[model samples]
Target: MSMLAGATLVASTLLGAGPASAARPPQAPAIPVAGLADPPAEFGTDWHDPLTAAPPVTHPTGKSCEVTVAEAQFRDFTPYKGTYAPPRGCGDRWSKVVLRLDGKVQGRQYDRLGYLHIGGVEVLRTSTPQPSPDGIEWSVEKDVTRYGDTFREGHDVEMLIGNVVDDTYTGIIDVKVTLTFYPAEKPAATKTATKTVAKAAAAPDHVLTLQDGTLTTPRNSERIVAEVYATGSGGGCEEYWYLTVPDAAPYSCKAGDGPYREVQIEVDGKLAGIAAPFPTVWTGGWSNPFLWYVIPGPRAFDIKPVEYDLTPFAGLLNDGRPHRIDVSVVGVPEGQSGWSTPVNVLVWQDAKSTRVTGKLTAHRAGDLTNSSTYTSGSEHRLDTGAGHRLTVAGYVDTSHGRVTTTVDRELAATSVHRWTDGESTDALKGTWTDDEKVTVDGHGPAVTTRTDRTYTMDGATTLGAGDRLRTVLSLGDRASVVETRGGRRTAWSRLDDSYAGDATYTANVPRDQRHAVGTTSERYRLYGSDGCYDRRLVTVQGTLTGVRDSC
Candidate 1:
């Protein structure tokens, strides 16, 4: 019987008259509270009273009632049905006990809460404090209380009961209470009547079915879906499974296996899945293929065969510029050899479109040379030798001798490309259509290269202007500006990339530091790699004067 029933029995036995005052109505059932008692082992063989005496009934109000009661609750089983991470709902069966005063209802509480084991680790506890108009029949309240505890296989419940009451006529009260055991609902192999009721009213948002021994969520529109998959029960045999909700309807539960039904599915604070009830939706599950994540790009390089010798080259080719060796290749997918025949080369600065290519020649295993190139923008050029040529976009840098060359356009080359003796002489091919932006050293070039061959390396000095210039200097990191300046020789304050106070920036070169320039002759150092005849040349001359970055 429910706890409220017991309260009504006591109240009816004492209040012989029909209910009167608004504050004191016919007694209502009370919620149970914690009542577990220490076992017989704690008391030993000593004989004792079956009922423990109730303490004096004391309240803030001076008036006192004549009777008292006590109650305890026990659980036969918990409600969890499967090994779920977060147990979804309450179990199928539950019962409670209540004790109350003979003629009045004081206060009540309930304990012995229980629920299912989730993931074989957590206990899902659920309780409902209900109210009833008729003392015999109970009505479930809308509000539900739930909690979790660690799951233990052989768990049981125990409690003790005691209470006290005072007499309204003499200020003296009698107390009597008993401990009772009620069978708890256990998880059944098949659904029970009560279980069916809970399922019909509180079904989860998902449902699952195993096909060919493989589990799959057929599809449903239920707002709350409960899917069950059985892995190895014990002894370590395990399996994996998943259920996907393709779509959702507000406050609805949809499933793959059945017709749409209204249900509520909540994950965290937000609605994760919902669907409309009745009238099945969607013919079948959507086809979503398994996807592989993109792998990380390469970090280091193994050299490719890249070299050219314009030893026998002639002047004045197609662009009116003197000819030299130019070579190029398209990006080949991993494990494939040779380049793609370009109908049109697509050059892109982003990592997705650009391809990296590198070549290194080794004198021996330990001693080697490395040249690497990153392709940028791509275009189509048909006039060279092949049907179409990909644009030459990125700069090529070699490590052995610091060989660097910037390719601005597509150069002409043959389609029958091959490496013989790990060496090839082919002119760089492709269109120069995207070479609109230019940078000297690392700094932006405000003026076009055509407008000024005299480029600023950093924001400090100028390079080639008057022939009698002494020391030329350029400085900056990769992203900013480069300046250069030079003038007739004088003991001028330091005025290059370094600050004026630097020892190298001395007001005058100390006698010991006079060898800073490392030059006494008029000869300039040929600043070219083994591949280029002449690229950059550094020189020194008489009458040095510091020229700042005016341009």
Candidate 2:
């Protein structure tokens, strides 16, 4: 079957729902239908299964093997623990590794966050979709080849999807995770001269996890990178940190510094890296679960970690001593706990050298700029703007010679939130941009890579006549990257992912009587030196109506 046809089949089968009604009476007949249909809508026993337009993991063509990592049903705080062993037939070195998680849930349930860890290295951080009464099944795949080092050995695995299963909320999250590995191809034996393909860089030599907020790297570490799975959650205000207001403002969620939040990494009491966290909206976000019954927000299913090039600090951490390495979310209220930051450090060692020495040549951090103004009136408004910049440079004496690396990062965000008294109508429009540049000057010519990232959210929720609530939202995630050698562009890539939805339902009503109606769509386009991919998905009520591939 075609991709679109397959998607439609899956949506129908998984949701276990019927076709949407064409003509139905609206709760408030006087309110003219504005681009949306009336309710007694499609939502019956279930809705369209959750899905995204992101590209799937491409498997390599070679001998392969699969291993089941974890299988369990999560209903509370308890986690699933098991042992993970490498595939038997697959060799230690793999050309590619893919991790896939399949999950199913039925009955009523709220969106819950989850994670998977092997040997204490976090490999996946995801969130579940609010389930339909009948049930729904979804899957997510990620290319985990970078964590090859962690998978080569037998290690303990832990997985959790914190949830509550009571009489009212009866969904139990059932999940099974597996890994597939493909062996590397042998080099061709040819006497004749042939074009050579540059082999991709090897995976990290070691994957190290933090111990009590401290890190210890290999003495001969030549290159180091740190990835942090930072999330603002705990079913509290931090989950909606972007919409928070200052303490003086009359709002449900309050942050002393307003809605501006930045994720920062510190090493030995000094700033190492800074980043803007992506504003992720769960399936039930904005008080409208119908908006996401078919399509979720960007990065909602597969949460990508904030990466930092920590090679500059390799010298400081290579002393064979545990150094204090901390991750913190700025702008959170003091003494409040709602953020989870689990760190994984990847290290590349100097194979030919027993020990490598280096020094941090430069470290500079500009003052943080944050401003939030609140205006009180019939429509209360809060406006905020924040930014920060950091630059670090260092050199390591490797077996190949001296290698100098420099990293620069900048983050900026602006948001405007407006709401009526008692939050009868709430609206927010926000944008965040993160730009980073890395330069490496070694034995050969200097090479530089620049990446620019942008995220946007424009959404509003309003309560109207007959206790009918409506939400209209649009979200965007875009990025562009360029690699230059000696000031000449060698490679470039661009990505644009956007989502929009309009949904409405009766407020404070039983699940079956809410009369929810929604229309959601997503368009994902990615182009790079390798190739191009573009796909669009649309859903009305609970059925997948459109799935188009333009590229």
Candidate 3:
């Protein structure tokens, strides 16, 4: 669960899957990014040894089964459905499906989670990863491949392992589930020829709930978007909203108490791509299960509507001219002014795809000037000799401490492709010895490797304003790891939406090596504070938690 394969193909669809075949038909699906080719057909944990007796079974796709349940009384519950059918004519070659789960749960107590239905919906959901380091195993994966039309309509795909962990609590909960199919006989969708630029009718898209959220336009596309919906009003730490393509800009700032933020994309301006901001499918009211986790997925929904890819700057948005697509937001929601957060500014033009030439030399971006100190550094470069060559440097030093608001954002990036969604945040309201360091590098031989990284977050938090105060939160991640490139081993694997450790790759990182680089939490709340009380701190996947509303 080192952040669970850094998964974040969040709603992806371009479809591609057509390789690997012993004549195909073993159920097919190994979700290796889908297109298929090599081996691609894996299942783990000896095919479900003791999963918890079930009431469903119809294997065929890489057949493997098991279900067992011994006891449970207190907060008792059960929902272990099943389904695996894929030997028919193969619905338009469906193309895409990957569901992996390695298990090991010898409970000291209990509290389970798992659900990955197919047509009956429920897409994918998991939570049994936290074992590793000798305590047995733990693995997880989900790329439902958009259901492949509910597995070509055969239906029945289900998986629900449940346990509330109460009723005096009984133990035992083991799991293993696998599905890999990337079929494509005649269908796989990948046309390409889009051109939907729009957002000028005086800047459309609304529902900011209160105020301050804008999206400008001048437009030229290759995929430039700013679809927003962050609803947590009153959370700040510089309060962000930026996206300029002309002189390079990409920011979606957040100090923490997150509803799961992260939305940055700047191509001509440098840093291209980073998406994470879509939740809010529904949010009725009363919520404070200790601040908030209203639990149930998408990080508990804040209002949904999140989509950001920027198409890797689509060659800096194809220079056919026209360019000004701005977006603004300053402490929206909860900071006052009614608190609204909604903005939609999209552009997607992939006419035929190539026509590249780049230059983005932003060597600095740390200017809060009189707002109370700031200084950022950069050294960007992007060449597209048919594509592949992106070097980005980094430096940041922020200070505005009285109560606390210090930041240090040192980043590095090299690209030969492979930089999706986004995740890089560091906010400290005060004291980490003041925290400040910089020197991050980047080199991308087509995603080859070269990342000299240095941007750390140690830990700190304190709150109390009276009215029976009680809101203690502590966050830690003594940041450390690689800062070199070349060869086939670069550390800093993948931990989207939250900076600070939880690697996977293996690029060789020994620079300032410091493990346990993240995930060291401590939270306690009691909010009736009456006046001042707002929060923010996220790093879910590497740990470091704290999300707002404490009373």
Candidate 4:
């Protein structure tokens, strides 16, 4: 069980009845309080709730049905188990499905990690927020329409927020989750309506679970995708993997290979895909909970899974044989444990063909490059670099014709870490990039979709005079996607999410004497092809100071 999972807070003034109106013009989300005073000299019993600049889940109108997934109070490692059934009022077909989770906690507690699984399919991965003495409440929403097949039928549900409640930690997490389904609008003709319904629910025909790290797909599977919820946690050094140093370095956390880490997927001993995991900073990260009392670094409350397009391996997996599929992280000690990876496979099958046959045409892998150099001085330093590339191609016979899919992926990372003699002042600057291109032939003109993702981190924590500690941090998550057919651009999109924070507090003292003060902000901007969205949020001393939506 992982020690930390999460939540964030929203100001009472910023709370809305539902998703914001898209047509509304850009403006301040909340009016600034008149004559807002400076922060107090010491910590208080209460503060503003955690919040982010991320957009809310938009819903469609017509008719909707809702179902309660789970409701429980988590105080230990025990998991809440229940059963979920589709809503009766709404038909089997749904135009969109949205998931919402509301949680509240009070008293003293550390961040804990949690996950929600329906019928053995992982739907949401999250972490909890540390609460003030007066307590706090938060909510998060996600689009689970892609998991339509999982919710269409009754399934056993399981949820857990691993925690410990004793004399020192007293916060018990209370949460409730629900799913709302929007029915598709009626069309003029019955045949057209049938087609529209089918297209609307064209997510995946089958959702398969991994048993003992093995997978067996249907013989006629046409497209295959695997999503892995990989997290490095367990309240240990792995939780802060980026700060690890070589064994020779006199650091508290040491890794044999320094701080470069990558997540890789393998099928039957052959590498299938590789991805750079998002460096998540929990609510209590960087030895300071005050920095994240309001806005988390990035993707802290909601963890998005790393996805792999295994269509190139559909030919091999369609053999109807149990094949071993393994997920592993590259930079851990020989016999240590600190990572969790749970996988779910999504498949689309051919209606006409009972068996789809093909062969693996080509597979190429570039040598992995990894290097770490260390220097000892008043300011110890560690410089690290790593990268890898993989390309795979295969063809499968389908109802339409013979189809070929090729996938090319590349990942690279570089970082510079520095710290004092006793680790009084520790800092790091790092960047990771993952680039992928998928091309499919034999379906009209050849089409290709390319995606470029980049992640960054820059932060420093220092212990100064009078037991005073300060931390300054900045993080970024950026990506761009483009699609082209026959060398002509067809569509594209871009996203830039950034966060910055500065916090200070007196260390090694009672909660009431810590005298903590901090300010944090996040700006999320997404634009292209479909539309544009821009939002920024700022918080000072736990109070939401500003929220602007420029687009």
Candidate 5:
């Protein structure tokens, strides 16, 4: 299948856009259909019944798998693939779609899922039943009511049951699908109201505000925007500066081979902050742009936003004097590790806000090291650094609040690879692992902290049928914890967490095309009897794919 692009709203380019002024964003996906007061009727879709093939027990593996499978494709050079666009559909909608994958069908991995596409747009995703005692032989029912606007008559709908996680399996399977349509009893109606909050057009004589005006025009407020993206094919492991948070931690870069850590920030030539890992999935990845563009992950419903507590800096920038600011990144130009980054800084101001003017300190395409050689004979081995860091700097007054600022940055990563028959095809198969860790703390005029934090982000393109991508992680005691005044480690958790599963996404495209990539993000939370800490947040509106080439 082909690769999938985000909708118009998700992963949109912020460059040249003015400050966010709309009360209601145009990207919101709200369907017009009324909720079913009664069970709706089903419109029989198409499918192959009567057991075309044998179903899987714990699913199937490599050779045992039997089904029309899909795979993840690897890439080397960066193709200027623009963001994904949805297909133009008939003026109609559906409420639901029922997908049935019989037990007789075999697939590669259960962790990853297959995708269903309609008219070239992803409409549904299917799960597997392995490792789970029950739930096997069960069917998956998805609510497509939201995307009702994207459906039409004679729409080309197809199902893909294979994923990149199983290169070892030439899986096979059978599929069946059904759709439920709802005819509006009456035409839907919408209401719109606009409210504007007036503010003095003049800044306080004593207030000074400085923000990065690249992604978005300067804004007046206590808000910040940061990002990560690639501009080139990332020779090996690429790096780019995101933002400078006066100083702290929550991010890291890589050390060659693969995974890496946060980017460090410096203020006034001093270590200022560390970039924390916060995912831009919701902002960049959506289900269906127009209708059901919601996050597929229950936990990441795309609501748990990332923000840095810069209120403490409010008092520092009150001096009215212009300050200097600079940001940079590091890494190799390899696969989808990471590349050119764009950062937008927002420091809302009144009379209490000051200024930050500085030079772009030590900035360059860092030379990531590649040590620890791996021997790939009978069994392949890897021993190389996987992470690195970034540092942004600037000059500004001190926050009068002197009140400590508390912020958390979450980090994560995932990847897929395929080692050809250099040794044995299965000997060195592809793997994809995702991890989340955070480093939370506090910093300000009253309390400035210094620490060494880094992260290694792993990204890869979708796997083609027979491609392999498995998780490869070796965490140590979640050692991402810190020692506060009390020997107690604060619990870093998903505050609004509803789902914490593996990184999974599916799309339906041309059989000649490959889509779906693996990516990870991490976070940090401070834990002290008296809660308070500091950290920086960096998000990448970038692509997550390995080289678009095969092993």
Candidate 6:
């Protein structure tokens, strides 16, 4: 039972060379410290860049996924009593797991799997939180814990994978359960088995020509070159041609008087004249480089290509590997209560077309549906994806129960969208009363009529260039700016509440401000000065910016 859950955690702590040691608990099941001298290993390689294509392994490229699982030690951080000590049975065979990549068993250690048929014993769950590339390490999700009580039999487990510290790519890396069991007992560990998996050969990249045609070879040939000759008659003209190759003697052509005779022809490789019955002659052969001759005149002629044997330009391969590009589109589907499902767009460069088909999600119509004092206007939400710029420009007509939303041609948002039935009530609605019009509590209908069927956005979402850290702040004329970190919204207040006055105002990005550079935390504060507090609401509305890498 202990091996089934806690053992993986313990093993991960012992193997990982990170903060896992400090973050791990002393009482936690001990990691089996033996047999690492010759343990198996693998690598998970993502061959594509996020802006160009999806991983060929998962797409139509038919390439297999490369797996790389590093053995690491945990650095326990939880506070402990007096002298810190390791947990009991730290070296006992506690668990075992078989690693699999794309359904293929890749690695395994631990006899429990073979003996008892337990699947998860050999697997080790990581405790170190994925760190940001900026060298800052922070755990986004809590480490998985093993339950000591269920030790007799082993359980199944999986470790999520991706560029833990990089937010550029989409989807988590998943190592599936394969091996059957792991010995909970500790033994002298030996490490050394697989160093790295062999990667596939890179493919060639062709350069597009001015006409859009890919240029794979040069236009010069050496075998046989065809020459053209033209002749004009009383009413029109006529022409004929053939191929020849001059291995040595400098090649030349001629018309009348020359071996090949004609009026307006070529001789010693020179044009002569133009005449009917103009027997324009040429040679058909191949040389290191091929050449062609053009005769002018309005005439009829038939010619054949001279087969050539020559060396063309050798082909070259692309030294740069094709990168995986992530593409996602988020918007609300028409006609739904909450929000529409978020649409995920996926495209593989090795495949045809950039159109992606995936799932979507929806959200609430109003920003504050739970607030009792205020009624929200019509609105919906949508997203393109993290670090991507998305602009949604379209009309929402809800009066007929049909909601039509067309995003701008260039906009791509990877987020959820909501739908509205198209209806809102304000002071114009008279009062809030049930259809019975009994006036309910005896008080007059509320002042503002709550409206529905409105349209709004899920707003803009921005994530850190590496850690996925995000913050969003929105502003409006009568509305104060509300800021949200992660998903929690911050309370709003004037930059300086002491100031008293009725003034018109606006917010602006400081000209000298280099908003997104060199820092884990970026700051944006609301400021209200002088008499700018009561009179005008400076609605400074804009999506969060500078979360992705520096532009």
Top candidate when judged by TM-score against the true structure: 4
TM-score of 5: 0.32
Tens-digit lDDT string for candidate 2 (361-393): 999999999999999999999999999999999
Query: In order, what lDDT does every prediction score?
Result: 0.17, 0.82, 0.27, 0.83, 0.26, 0.17
lDDT of 1: 0.17
Stretches of candidate 1 off by over 4 Å are 1-126, 130-272, 275-551
Per-residue lDDT of model 5, residues 1-551, tens digit only: 11111011110111111122111112212222331122112101111111100111111112211112122221111211212222233123211222223333333322233445544434443333321111122343333332333343344454544433345432333344444333322232432212111211111111112344212212223323322221211212231211110012111222343433344433334333334343222112212111111112221211111112233333333334343433333233234444323232334443454442222223222333323334444433433333323323222232332222333333322222223222112111111112222222224222222222222223222323444222221111011222232234322211111111122222344222322222222222222222322221111111111111110
lDDT of 4: 0.83
Which is the winner by TM-score between candidate 2 and candidate 4? 4
User: Number of clashing pairs, model 4?
Assistant: 12
Write the number of the candidate with greater TM-score, choosing between 1 and 2: 2
Q: What is the lDDT of candidate 2?
A: 0.82
Q: Could you give candidate 1's per-residue lDDT for residues 304-337 as a string of tens digits?
A: 0111111001011111222122112221112423
Model 4: which ten-residue window has the lowest total lDDT?
Answer: 4-13
lDDT of candidate 6 at residue 372, scale 0 to 100: 10
Cα displacement (Å) at residue 438, model 3:
36
Worst 10 residues of 5 by lDDT: 6-15
Best by lDDT: 4
Model 6 lDDT-worst window of ten: 430-439
Clashing pairs in 2: none
Off by over 4 Å in 3: 1-94, 102-106, 109-126, 129-141, 144-177, 187-262, 268-307, 316-551
Give each model a TM-score.
Answer: 0.12, 0.91, 0.24, 0.92, 0.32, 0.16
